[model samples]
Target: MKVFLWNETGKEKEIMLEDDQITVPADKGKYIYEVLAEWKNGEISYTFVAEVQ
Candidate 1:
């Protein structure tokens, strides 16, 4: 599995996972994220947006 994050400026960055967990950025703003899961038979992807205050 892999995870990535993108800011409003379109800057993409890879997120590191610790024990299947991740820490969101502290800056207050909106962000986009993409998650990819792969298997021997197939693969899947997902995207979503989040807002932080």
Candidate 2:
């Protein structure tokens, strides 16, 4: 699985995971997180917003 983190400034990073957990540095604001799941036949992805205070 792969995880993507993006900020308002367009700064982003991609992290590869073996299991299903990852830690990322987040600033106080709104951010987006995208997760991709890879399969043998196909792949799927999902996106959500993260609000840091």
- The local distance difference test score of each candidate is 0.83, 0.77
- Clashes by residue pair, model 2: none
lDDT of 1 by residue, 1-53 (tens): 98889766763888888998767778898778888899999999888887889
Q: Which candidate tops lDDT?
A: 1
Quote model 2's TM-score.
0.68
Clashing pairs in 1: none
Q: What is the TM-score of candidate 1?
A: 0.81
